[model samples]
Target: MKTRQFFASLAAASILLAVPAFAADSAQAFVDKAAIGGKFEVDSSQIALGKVQDQSIKDFAQMMIRDHGAANAKLATVAGEQKLKVPSALDAQHQGDLDKLKNAQAPIDPAYVDMQRKAHADAVKLFETYASGGDNAGLKTFAQQTVDTLKTHQQMIEKIAAGQDAITGATTPAVKTDNTPNAAALVPGANSFTEAQAKSRIEGAGYTNVSKLTKDDQGIWRGHATKAGEGLAVGLDYQGNVVAASK
Candidate 1:
């Protein structure tokens, strides 16, 4: 009995020691993949800004550049603190995505929008998985916070795709616009507050539980807020406008 109990204790000790190693590995893998994805988004969007004739597509590409660039910076800081080595170059798969975007034929708006939708959809899944069950605590928090931003990007890209389909009479499924109170459109450039200022403004506007706030290049701040026991998609634009959309 003593021998069996001793062996069981040893096994438990081994498992305990292995947990951090597994977490570190998970964190490293996440950082590597996220770095590559951010680079791909920014680079491809830059290309699209120059190539796509559609104004809305240009706007979406600019938003991607700004948002992904900020996210990459944050991830880099976290990776450095965690002693993880994030890859400096795109992986082969992401490289192929970039190549595809660059070589896509005329009417590049639709193709570009399609790619953005798919990429963002994948990104949402990746972030959601990490947020829910990742071994690393800090990165898990980061993932959880970032998931909202990725979801917003996905929704915007889907809207663009649907609009494009409408214009071209394509059979692509149309996104139904919700008429709920939280479904208000973002008024870009409607506010001039920096992110910090936007937070203050949001608090002043009687929003509680404000978090996950992010500001795009157009000075639009997006995240969650609550008022009257209802969740809202709240934003402050560059033109100093504060607006809330129903969730």
Candidate 2:
């Protein structure tokens, strides 16, 4: 039993451990890992945007591009202000992941989503550790702010993977959730997002022709919409949950 447990631990540590490993050592190490990992998210999502067919995956990729691009820029500013150099390129491991995605054949959505899930897990570990125990105040604060988005990314990828696996068919995506940098209750409540902002967020989740949007007393925005050639009853809750049900 001890031998089996020991090997299991080693095997688990062997996968995607390098990224988080860097962040555990020092402030400089954390910065390097964070920057390189952010680069990987943006670059790979750009590839997915071109190749992946599922609208959910495409929407997820778009979110990743926008969020990580912004996050990377924020990290750059923080790094410069703190006099730390952010790495401009993906390291060996991440570059290898990107190359694999590029070479993957049609129906790349599964591969892309799976890669995102694992990558985001590692990223969450790196950021959470740095946020709580890093050596620098500025970098720690950045990590603190960025980790939640990483977690939401992980959750999104997981749903994508599960949605794809629901059938032995093509990689159809699952539920589309908005991780739009905010802290609102999962249940409806006084929504802070404006009506236009709500529509934009819902549209960003891949719904189109959105109309009849009205906020209920519960603070959930309910509306009509279309997705993947099918009309859906769409609603946006305070927590950025853009749910689509059959009409």
Candidate 3:
């Protein structure tokens, strides 16, 4: 009777141990999927850099590359500490998306913008779920922090999509013909410029009241500026192009 009781107690302890192990396995699965998603965003955006002709689309793609690349690096470090393995390649679904982007025969800007909208929407959902109740404590915190950035990206992409739709419907050329040089050409390799340096460059270009300077996910410096007493929204792209849109 004593031996039988002892064996029963040991089996109960073993089951108790198995429970946490199962939870850890679940956490590992989330980590893997999250990592893959980040990689997909970075890779797809890189492809857009070469294929997109629209400056706005290119700017959006640059932001994806910068933001996703940073997030992926942080995630890799977190996963490493927990002994979870992250896959370097995209899964089948993401690969399919990439293929479509590469082979798109339609105007590339709309196609790319549409894809970004869908992708970010799904990403926001995924991060929200994991952040709210995932088993991994460390990764849960990471997810919560990252959800804000994901939402921001979503909002930006939505605006881009709407603007692109309007541009597509218009009959006139997107920009009037002028002798002005491309603003992007002025600062070659502008991505390397610090925020202060970028601000100086904007000021040098005859913009005043430069305030609310913030770097968006695409490594662009955006803020409010005034040229001849008119308020304007302006952005400096990674390649040093100063793009201004009238308010």
Candidate 2 vs. true structure, TM-score: 0.59
Give the winner by TM-score: 1 or 3.
1
Write model 1 residue lDDT over 1-247, tens digit each, in one string.
Answer: 9999999999999999999898898889999888888888899899898877656677789999999999999988888888898798988887887888788774477668877888898889999999999887778888998999999999888866654553343111122335232213445554544466566556645578888898766657788888778777776554334567667
Candidate 3's C-alpha runs over 4 A off are 1-11, 105-107, 171-247
Extract clashing residue pairs from model 2.
none
Instruction: List model 2 lDDT by residue over 1-247, tens digit each.
Output: 9999999999888865975555444777888988998999999999999888766788899999999999999999998987778898889999999999899885587789888988899999999988888877889999999999899989878866754553222112243344231213235578765688667767655678989898888888888878888776677666556666666
For model 1, the run of ten residues with the poorest summed lDDT: 167-176
Top lDDT prediction, candidate number: 2
* Candidate 2 deviation (Cα RMSD): 13.5
> Which regions of candidate 1 are displaced past 4 Å?
105-107, 170-247
Better of 2 and 3 by lDDT: 2
User: Using Cα atoms with residue i matched to residue i, what is each candidate's TM-score against the true structure?
Assistant: 0.65, 0.59, 0.64
